[model samples]
Target: MPQETFTLQIRQIRLETDDVLSFELASPTQNPLPVAPAGAHLELHLPGALQRSYSLLDEGLGGCYRIAVKREPQSRGGSAWLHSQARVGQTLQAQAPRNDFALNEHAPESILIAGGIGITPLLAMARRLNRLGHRWSLHYAAPSPDRMAYRDCLQALAADGHGSLHTYCSSEDRRLDIAAVVRASGPQAHLYCCGPAGLIDDFITATQDRPPERVHYERFAARHAASTEGGYEALLARSGKTVKVSAGRTLLDAILDAGVDIPYACSQGVCGTCRTRVISGTPDHRDECLTEAERQSNEAIIPCCSGALSSTLVLDL
Candidate 1:
């Protein structure tokens, strides 16, 4: 797989519905898209917009990369800019592909549950599985069929006899039952889910009894925020260097300000690229990338966007 910077032109942009836009980005070169897994996402640097992570929707071939963007009315300009400001023919900087969510290699069957825009990554997975002629099923739940992104693509997959695709529209019917569907999916099936907070929470609660390791999930929203010092001190362990960051400044910013270079992306803490070992002090882990156990162990921290709570944090640097 190739990992190189590319400028992608917005060859086409279609409003799938009032809240979603299906953007088909034209590649600059002829190389095929990297072989991305089910839950892989790319970092997009939209001009004048903050770096945001978007799940890859393309099947890793074709001349273009497709992504579905949901208009986030509550976001701080990320989704809003993507929906309102982005125009066709415009080019944007984007990274190739990265995967945090992958499939269970040895599993015989898999079940995919998607909520709203969370369907983007799973859609890619479904396409890949269909291409390989594998056994899988997808249950997609949305507020309405009109608001559902990539409805045509998913429909085509179902039409081709790839797998069963279930659509649950909650607007017209008050009794959209996801629990029953999940229950019938059977045990030993590798399950993957993505989407909004309410849906993710419901699914997590619904399938809590499943094998803890088999349930793979990812959050599109930022994780919990704690009352850290607003900012704190980061000590470079090897160099014996110290940098003070006030409220609003991240530990990565403080280190880079002191002429230290650390790899990072999606500074919002979604990508685990900037994760470094925590040598000492209390780490106020605020990243969406690490699990609860990883944070508790104090083994690593994403300093690029994470902060310190103990006033002084020693980093492996």
Candidate 2:
């Protein structure tokens, strides 16, 4: 299915930090927006056909959506454009909320670990957990207090005894011990983390002994793809066509260039929207969406970022 775009009026804008800004969006006609779960995200369709995803932070707020944007020093103009050009009273187009990191409500306990801007989704999780009277804790880390968003709100939660809030500011020589945090969560606790590659990697390593289904995480960016020496052939079984997937180009791009239409979001392969059945092929899977079992089955491929291990790959469509 194709994504439907809706216009959102910017209701408020606030500077959360030196490099971060929070934007509040509402339907132009005051209609109620779709309610999203704890860890859902909205895709903002920016100018020049650029789309960027931001975690929805307005947990308890109805009829409104809130998101925080952090200006990346090395951004390709997305954050910079929002920080400089976006303003209150302006209307922007956005897609409906979607979740790839959903909280397990039935878990005995929940542990949320957030780093810097990664706090967006975790904040929502905290609020939802508090509302449901569920046991949860948040471990937030940032370079400094000045760079952290929603500090006062998190502190308020701590003061109200909703849950424990442990903060680590690297500038103050406080480092987050991932191993200790995981161990402290206990065996029955469900752990969720979102952050830079280093923090996520360490968290995964620390929790390696635990059940894989009990640990969840989401990454803002995809890992760098390894280089391939030559191009591969992709056969579109339904269309009865063969396209060459170039060394540097993705299988998705090759298919699109051949005039095939497909549904896709977060072309980086994190959304699992571009997953297509594999008629016959050994896929060199690079997507984070598939699990070990799915990868081993070779039943589908996320063409947006994955490639073929065999010389010729045949796809269902």
Q: Which of the numbered candidates is closest to the native, going by highest lDDT? A: 2
Model 2: pairs clashing at backbone N, Cα or C within 3 Å: none
For candidate 1, give the lDDT. Answer: 0.77
lDDT of 2 by residue, 194-310 (tens): 989889889989999999999999886667572243378999998999998877778888888899876676777776767899999899888877777999999999888888889
Q: Model 1 residue 69 lDDT?
A: 86
Q: How close is candidate 2 to the true structure, as a TM-score?
A: 0.92
Clashes in candidate 2: how many?
A: 0
Tens digit of per-residue lDDT, candidate 1, span 246-312: 7766777777778876656666676776788988888888887788788998878887656776878
Q: In angstroms, how far off is 119's CA in candidate 1?
A: 0.9
Total backbone collisions for each predicted model: 0, 0
lDDT of each: 0.77, 0.85
TM-score of each: 0.87, 0.92
